[model samples]
Target: MTDPLVSLPAFREAAAERLGAFAHTTVPDSPGSRRAGVVLCVVEHEGVPSVILIKRAYRGRNAGQWGLPGGRMDEGETPEEAALRELREELGLAVGPAEVLGRLDDFPAASGFSITPVVAAPSDPGPLRPSPDEVHSVHHVSLARLAADDTPRWVPQIDGGHLLQMRLRPDWVVHAPTGAMLWQFREVVLLGREARVADFLQPDWTRN
Candidate 1:
């Protein structure tokens, strides 16, 4: 039997009712600020509502760190298009615009991009064929795990601000802006609460 808590019907219903009604915040792009889009690709895995993540190959500045399936938007592409394209390029999930559920806030990342996290569910959510050139590994984080009360933690930063951290595992933790994004997704989408993460500090530590 499928767990209704994590079933596709519930997910779709929540997005339609909550996400469609939630007034998501967006950051205005400033000069010199780049734009990127990330897909919060949700799926039903093992009867749990799960989201996809990628451990990037040791290739970029933040290589080997965890991320969603996305990249910087192309000149003519919308955020939704960029997100879906990246999902295809990096994870082989060729979902179209119809799969996009809604969007969360625009996180102004310390890394210089104003990132829009697009919530989506592939029509054929499946065994992801992650690109070897991009992803070191793929992970499915269950909403049940995310909704746990003790999942998010605040760690002191060198700058007197606090950085948000959450354990995907004791060994593999994700931090803001990814951590912030996930936390908001949990609060707003999963649990259907009003929450924002603009004040969450970007991480000061390396994933490794």
Candidate 2:
């Protein structure tokens, strides 16, 4: 028997209803900002709701970090379109626009990029093949793990706002903006908490 809380029907219903009800907050205007798109791809694996993440290739500014599969938006492309395209290019998963559930809060990276995270629930993500040039590995994180009350920790920040850090694996931990986004998804979509995490601070190492 599947866990009712992490079952596909409940995930879809909760995700759709909560995401549909909330109005997404966009990135604030900033000089020299570039637009980027990221996909919060959700799927059912072994009868549990899970989210996909990628360990970035050890090259870019955010090299070797676990984040969503996505990149900069192409010319004349919407955030939704870019998310789908990146998922295909990075993970070889082609999810159509119809599967897109909604958008989470826009995250502004310290790397001069304004990122929009698109939420989508694709039934089958196909055989995920990670692009060596972009992704080092892929992670399928179960929602049950994310919903645990002890999952996220409050780490003190220089600015007095506590930074959020969540464990993805025994040895792997992720922080905002990926951590913030994931926390928000768990709060609003999974538990319907109306929780907010954008104001959370990023670690000094990621503030490039």
Candidate 3:
């Protein structure tokens, strides 16, 4: 049988526990001309919780893959500010400062960026206008759906040169981008289970 869904407050407390103990590591591509921040907006609909995911336009790296709404952080801006800005620019959603939940662990990319994910609650909900130049589509997936039995399966990379490793499961996979946060959200917030980066292997594509 599947586990019961925990309350939102319960989830937050659990997430804090895991994030507090996470360590920071230097990314492979350290020095870069630019940096970015992303938002992993988690929302609830009629008591069922879901996460906001977006498909980037088929351009640049990791295109057409599912990810959170975010992009490069502008100069002289905090990660939180960058996250909020990205949401408005990409999704045309205006979220108030009060809606921000908290910040998650920073995950660096092989593309020379250290991304900080800011978790927030949407002030209003409805149809969203996605920036055609950057976003292809948006999906609101429930946590329960993510935890469902038929969720997408992630195949771990076998090559040794990869920096991030992951394992496929019903709800989510572990890698960079939203991987670490997803793991933390599940282990700490959802199941109250303890997990570490070493607990799972990195996917091969992250190394490239």
Candidate 4:
């Protein structure tokens, strides 16, 4: 059967309910470091749902990885504020406070930032211009594509294994740099399921 219509509020509520179960207690305390925020913008087109993803420029840290629109949270700026700021800075889109549905559990990066994914809806559909300073391109992939049974696989990285090793599709794969909030957004909010980071397998770029 086709999935029921998933509204922003419904998704947010589901995320909030699931947050308590997945919430992290102790964040890493490092010198000169601070909390960060991210925005997961979900937009609907012609009754079909999709999400906005950004391809970071292959120059700086985590270059060429697929991720959402987000960056570091400035002092005194709330997660919601940081999300809006990042969206405007990266995509030149103005998303207001009301558009935010709610927040999901903060995903800690191995690189050190405690990233929070803020879920929001756009006021209207319009042209999106990618800022060359940060983004390489912006594209919308259908939720249906991600939810499909066809799993993504890659070759396992080894010193001298067979040239072709089958790697299982990760439950989530938010590319580096962009810090794309992939897995949790898909399983928890969209699919209403829970997944572990270990469930995902990173691709071997050398094989590609």
Candidate 5:
């Protein structure tokens, strides 16, 4: 049997409902702990629900890394506010606070900042104008691709140990803490499952 078609409004409604029900965890701000907000922007592309990703312009440690469009929160700014501002700055998508579905746990990054993932949708997610100053490229990955098997994997790190990663088109490995944020969005927002992101060293899911 063929599955029924899901309209854009219906999809967004479902997402909002699921995300709102989840209790998001917060990481308290400590000395030397900065606050950064990364958006999990969802859109319907060719009838599929997709998420936006960005490749950082070659700039020190974050160069060439695929991540959500965002940056450090400005003084007195909320996480959702920062995420929406980033959507406009990075991708030219004028997303608003109303489109912000919900949020995930605060992820502690090796870079010494706590990242807050704000799940949202743009009013007009269209032809993106990426900022060369910050974005090297843009990708719209389908949510289905994220929830698929063999996507979130434990990859061998160069120095030692391993890090969690999410594989995209043609085997592009997005390493954590970006990978960790994506996984949380997939499980908590898309799949409507309980999830939490701690350190990037381990998967946050407890199902065995």
Candidate 6:
């Protein structure tokens, strides 16, 4: 039998329901550790479920890497607040609180930071303007693409957890905490599995 046709509103409502079933929490901030917030901006492009990502500017610690649009939250700002603000700051996309779908588990970064991933679905993302100082380029990645067979692999670590390698193309590899978060998003939001990727290790290149 063929699957039923689901409209975008129906998809968003169902996605919110699935995401809301879990209680999301933030990792305790370690004293003197950096705190950052990233967003998984889900948008429907040509009837395919997709998320927006940005290539980091080629100067910072994570230079030339693919990542979610976000930055360190201003003092006294919440993660959700930070995510939305960063979206505007980095991509010139204004999204309201009601556009947010849900939050994923908190991820502790090996780079001495605790990061939060906020999921949002905006009905229409107007023109995209990437900030030259923070983003090199912006990419719209579809769920169907991310779920492809050759996209992800598990490399065992010395510790017990596995390192998740998410490939955007043949030459590009996405490292945690971005990889871990995307893996979680794929597993939970896309596949509906109770998956967790908080303990995954970052690539050695991200340790600077």
lDDT of 1 at 202: 70
- If the candidates were sorted by their lDDT against the true structure, best first, what order would they fall in? 2, 1, 6, 5, 4, 3
lDDT of 4: 0.61
Candidate 3 segments whose C-alpha is farther than 4 A from its true place:
1-30, 45-47, 147-175, 193-208
Name the lDDT of candidate 5. 0.78
Which residue segments of model 6 deviate by more than 4 Å?
A: 1-7, 157-161
45-135: candidate 2 lDDT, tens digit per residue: 7767788988999997688988899989988999899989999999999899988989988887776678899888887669888899999
Compose the digit string of candidate 4's lDDT tens values, residues 1-208. Answer: 3342345445445555555455433355578556777887877755666678877887775576677888888878988899889888888888888777666666556555677787777757356878887998777655665555552223344654222211113433443223224555566666777654322333444111
Residue range 107-201, candidate 6, lDDT tens digits: 88887778899888888667788999999988877877676778888888787777788987776678788988888887777667788777687
Q: Go through the candidates in order and give the C-alpha RMSD of each one to the true structure.
A: 2.5, 2.0, 4.9, 5.6, 5.0, 2.5
> Residue 141 in model 6: shift from native, Å?
1.1
After superposition, which runs of candidate 2 have C-alpha atoms over 4 Å from their true positions?
1-4, 28-30
lDDT of 5 by residue, 1-208 (tens): 2211134565577778887788888899888778989998888777877888888887744777778999889999998888788878988888878778888898888777788998887667667889888989888788778888778878786668677778876658876788888988878766778877685674332110
Worst 10 residues of 2 by lDDT: 1-10
Q: Give model 6 RMSD, 1 decimal.
A: 2.5
Better of 5 and 6 by lDDT: 6
Clash numbers, per candidate: 0, 0, 8, 3, 0, 0
Which has the greatest lDDT? 2
> What Cα-based lDDT does every candidate model obtain?
0.82, 0.84, 0.61, 0.61, 0.78, 0.81
Better of 4 and 5 by lDDT: 5
In model 6, what is the error at residue 203, expressed in angstroms?
1.2
Which 10 residues in a row give candidate 4 its minimum summed lDDT?
160-169
Across residues 71-175, which tens digit of lDDT does each residue of candidate 3 receive? 787879887899889988989888766666666556655555677777675647445789988898877666666554444344545553334322343333435
- In order of appearance, the predictions have TM-scores of 0.92, 0.93, 0.70, 0.70, 0.87, 0.90
Stretches of model 4 off by over 4 angstroms after superposition? 1-30, 45-47, 151-180, 196-208
Q: In terms of TM-score, how similar is model 2 to the real structure?
A: 0.93
